[model samples]
Target chain A: MASSPQLGFTTASGLEQDLAKLIVDSLRLEVAPGDIDPAAPLFGDGLGLDSIDMLEIALAVSKRYAVELRSENRAALASLRALAAHIAQQRTS
Target chain B: MMRSTDSQMAPVPTARRAFAPVAAPAYPLVAHDSPGCTLAWRRDRMHSVEEFLRSVWGLAAQLPPKRYAINVCKDRYLFAVGFAAALVARHISLLPTCRAEEPLRRLAERYSDAYVLTDHDLDTSMPSFHVTDHARHSSGSMKIPFIPADRIAAIAFTSGSSGFPQAHAKSWGSLVLGAKALGRQFALSSSPPRTAVGTVPAQHMYGLETTIMLPLQWGWSLHAGNSILPADIRTDLERLGSPAWLMTTPFHLKAYLSERTALPGLEGIVSATMPLTRSAAQEAEHIWQVPVHEIYGCTEGGMLASRRTADGDAWTLCHELRMRQESGGTWVKGGHVGAWLQLTDRITLRNRREFLLLGPNYDLVKVAGKRASLAALNAALLRVRGVSDGTFYWPDQGRSGNGRLSAFVVAPGVSRAAILADLRRFIPVYFVTALPRNATGKLPHEQLETFAEQVRHSGQARTIHECRRESFETEARRGFSQGARRDE
Candidate 1:
């Protein structure tokens, strides 16, 4: 998989890139997946995504990875890296 | 008659004072019967009526001396407290449809003395007071303030044609009456009190009536978090110790049913903001084991009618309201609606107390000498197998030079040709990942128009023949070379 690295940071992981693409595709964001900073916040100030976008992203995640992201576990939505970690942990568990 | 006049003459100064009307009738802030009753659920913790009143007083004292409070608090509980605080402070709350910069700028331009009452930091040039920081647990007396009935409580705004905020001022009496009517419509008092959990934002008029006001008027707890995701809603409902009534929209309902989201301790579901297809409502009722009720109202007025989707099509008017047909339009007055307000929807009055909705007046489209509403066409599109979400777009012939109707659909593994065939029409069908529905699940006219322009220019839109000629080929094989014919 093609992974894009941000300046002064390690290269984006495969799962992080996959999640970036998923967010872009599901929310129809104009930005390319590689342009997304994996460490940047996925909602509000960083990506500026709203609650409706969150719902769409959650549904897309559930459909693709079979890992349900609930708002109770809001940490999973902190960033692309956090979401990737959550998905990985869920799959392993 | 003589005895009645004699009694009137014998009235002392005290008796005369009792008969004289006060400056204005005062309505209590909270309508709950007891102080210990649960007013709101902040996360997993419930705030009693007494505690909520104290919070309101504390917030009211901390509020800046402003005439208008632009309430943009996201949390429903904080929103209620801010709303009550503004009332106690004798300030009118300004509810804008959105928190976007442009809308807020316009609101600020209109109300120069306004300040934002928010839960968190907001990017605005206007002065703001963070409501969360002022949520004090005051040890003051728990005396509920009585607001004058004629006082202007809040001013709600809708996007006007000119892109300016159109204000609708509501009085304290009218708001309370509307809340009471809403409670009576559901017969909420007939059963034990249930928490009001909502997927809609508390700012929207429908959301304000059902989630914020209904619970307060009927002594039910209001869920603070506005969870729209299926998993989130499930978790939120699970955390509630008491049974809850879900105040949601058709969009949220469809998502939950599709995912088979398990919502525990839900006694009922109220869907609004848009029309709910009968099939979807029936499926939700069957799966969730709760009666699915749909409310019919608009921003100009609070809820006016409601019906159990599983019951019938006709909507019974709220007991306090009356409707009449005048000059080919339906006007509702009485109860909460003080003035005779003409509804924009083309309605057929079934009787004095019930009416059948015929969709919005502007939604009527006549094709091939047959009349059909865009809502019905969209519903039909959704009913097609494998179709996830869709909308029928009728482009303005004057601007686009193409009057032909087109449709945008989000259906994976479904071909554009197949969708067109199922729709029984040959038109431009664009396969998209998703529709740009707003937070309330409403696809605004301007947004749809812009989306259509993008789709046309992006080469993503395709005609039926361009997609697949297989139907024609099959017809040719059968010796009917006249091309695919529309059944319609």
Candidate 2:
């Protein structure tokens, strides 16, 4: 799963790198892991992703990071950086 | 002996018929004894139509008085008031699909003296007015102005050929007649007044007719809240209480369904803007316990046909309209359409009234509830300074929820970043290059990774997040978060 950490996500700080790689791998977006900007917003506008996409991401994050993400948890779903921070605090892995 | 002038002098009484025809400029925009004064909702608050009229007359008094005005208010109530005020001021509303600065600027350039009206105080180059900027006026003892049925009321913008916005000029008579068709189609007159909540913006033609105009013309009311996450749609519906109807597009309906939030009770659902799949419509009917009636329409004509989307794909024309196909094209005449019209989609006539959507005659793409011409987007793509050749592609299936529009280009030495940046101005896009050793060459999937890497590295192209639009969205996000927390 961590195979091509040599580029995009691998260059980021440990926590966000893992999450970015997780999102890129799970959704199968045509962009690089590094391309999913750490501080970029995770919902709505910038991602061009809908809430349905977020559900897929949430399921993937729960399995990979071992943490439950509530849809109402604004901070946890705010952006990649915020999400990474929340995961760092709450991940049981 | 009676003067023909006497007939014109009196109020053209709205047809006493159970379902009646409305002449555009012939009758009052809002009837005198029409009874209900409830205008629409602005979030949780209910605004009265009387107060709405006061705002209209009040705002109309302050304007410099031009022949046309652009209403870009996001609040449905403000939009309603702005629209009515435009009519009262004898000005035509220039309804643009987007409130983006460039589009509004182009509209201002085209209309010359047209002013921008909105609730937000965004910096606009045109003469501008805010909804709250009105001098005092009274809602009481107000008289609804009778519009000449032939007067052009509004011009709706849609992407046409040549990559520029095309205008469909609609008159008050046609708009009113169209509303009457919808009222009859939905059986709105016999049923108790329904409170409509639309996910589509009121400025768009479908949104304008279904959410704003239908209710206003037919004596119902609307919820003023704007679009949020799907759960908020439920909140908006529940906030308005029972006997409510939903006016949304396939894109929004699918999103709201994913939330699985229950409304208090709904009368029915009215969807337009894009094709609603049978399954999506069925799911809504099964879960929300409401009949899903999809309005078949385009910017050129208002709501013309409707059908139970779950009942398969046959659409029944509004009882007043008739259709006949000529030269492989279907045309509709009569009622508020005001002229014999050509349809964008090819239709196979099932009878005098019902027909199936065979498919579009020309390519039109609806992504995330916005319909843009594929040819127009492609023309805009190739028009970009760096591009040699390009084309746009979106998912053919009903919104897979991935929601990203991709482009393929054949411009050698034109940095992918530059192409992307240029294209993003037209539509939010992600693209792959097929620049073989030859500029005009066959496309392949293998070169994507190498091309993406080069594109990512070249030029100072910015991610969507890096743009100024991101700040606006972030501000909106903060507001939505605050609202969500309160709901919690």
Candidate 3:
């Protein structure tokens, strides 16, 4: 589901947006989609999610994308832009 | 009798000095023959160490070449045997996973020919190599190979509480060093009581180091069973004899203390997993008359710091491991700190040598632009009278534009208003919501979302019990009204 094309979204961007929406939906964040900075921290200050939230997100991501989200990696935090890039890379390769 | 008195009473100081040889800094699993101590499994099963090792080695030889083995058994002997087998076979051992399936699949993907070595009873569909009864093999001294200490011994999975578990590769030397530091810090050898037992799973870092590794490395005998039931713990200690140490988690320790069982002789107790509350620590010590050693560590960083309750509040870092807080308030650089071992916890560094954890780093929530720690919120909730256990969860933002927190509590006697009043002391009114608990006393995260959905649809603030009643009434009324309409 493309929410909007003007969001400058590639297929990966669309996927990341969808995933971000899913995370927000699952965690029940009070913020709007427009408020979430793609590059801002989802864990600490920006989104303020805890380890349990991360675990829930990880499981959800794994079940949805068949991708393993390792907790110990910096890649775990990279930009929604980078996540989009990664998803695009995964999909293409 | 005069000659005996002359020899026996000849200044007791001389005899004490004679017995006190310079105690070498011993590693955790190195000490074996303590006075009145033998591996309980050996005594019960009638198998000596040499005999046990040979049998374990025999099993190792039977396995196919270069097979990766994962050991998940809670039994000390089985864990030891499997670890020895993996080493002897030069096969990689996969440490236990916190959440299975996805992580196991990832490991399977990496090590294509990996075989899980489990106890005979576990029904794993994956290709598994069963550990045979070691007693059946011949009685001979085990010729354990001198593998390089730096060799990647095993991969322990981090309990990634919010995501897929990550694997932390541990070298034998690093793990041994960490265990040695732990044993020393806890005074495993020099103390009055030398025995160590664990209630936590030995696969976890805290249990692995304190319970399994310390015994194997330092030669301290470990209790066979790993169960944490107070009765079982007391029984195991009595069976092992006095001056025993119980390695357990805050969860089990709290439960044990709550049960208020008459504890047997314990030299000390070591707690990990979650932070041990000061009140809990005091209660355990006061009730059991044993020192509670609080250990702080994670899979990525093997053994970080430990504090004996007798020594006061601060935790001293292990010998080799060092801690320095990053400018951003996270502790970094420990013994096993890998390339990306950034902690998920916040800590206040008193100095390089000691620090205090400030709870989960990511638990801070901004309500109407005001920052509040979720840990503080949950702690506040638990402080309320009659509130047993509670967790604050965020509601799905798509339906509700506000990212307010929803709470699931196991407060039996407390009313919703009372709980809200308690929360209101520290939190804003808009941040609170209600969620349901399943039968097992765990709030299924999905169910919380459903509760949130019900709240959103109904546009009402209903307690979990009230919501259930409303749903029941709605169903009953629909059934009756539909029947009357059809009859007319």
Enumerate the chain B TM-scores of all models: 0.72, 0.76, 0.66
Q: Candidate 1: which pairs clash?
A: none
Could you tell me the TM-score of chain A in candidate 3?
0.71
> Each model's C-alpha lDDT?
0.78, 0.69, 0.60
User: Per-residue lDDT of B211-232 in model 3, one digit per residue for the tens?
Assistant: 7777766656666675454555
**Quality of candidate 3 docking, DockQ:** 0.01
Give the DockQ of candidate 2.
0.08
Docking class of 2: incorrect
Clashing pairs in 2: A8-A34, B24-B149, B24-B172, B24-B173, B25-B147, B25-B148, B25-B149, B37-B49, B41-B224
Error of 3 at B121 (Å): 1.9
Task: Tell me each candidate's i-RMS in Å.
Answer: 9.8, 6.6, 12.4
Query: Which lDDT tens digits does candidate 2 get at residues B60-168?
Result: 7777678887989888887887887787677899988776677788788899978887889876767888875562357423456667777778999878755788899
Segments of candidate 2 deviating more than 4 angstroms? A1-30, A40-93, B1-25, B31-36, B139-141, B360-362, B366-371, B378-488
Q: By TM-score, is 1 or 3 better?
A: 1
Instruction: Give the DockQ (2 decimals) of all models.
Output: 0.26, 0.08, 0.01
lDDT tens per residue, model 1, B350-442: 888889987423354433223345665676677666889998788765111236567899999864444655553435678888998999897
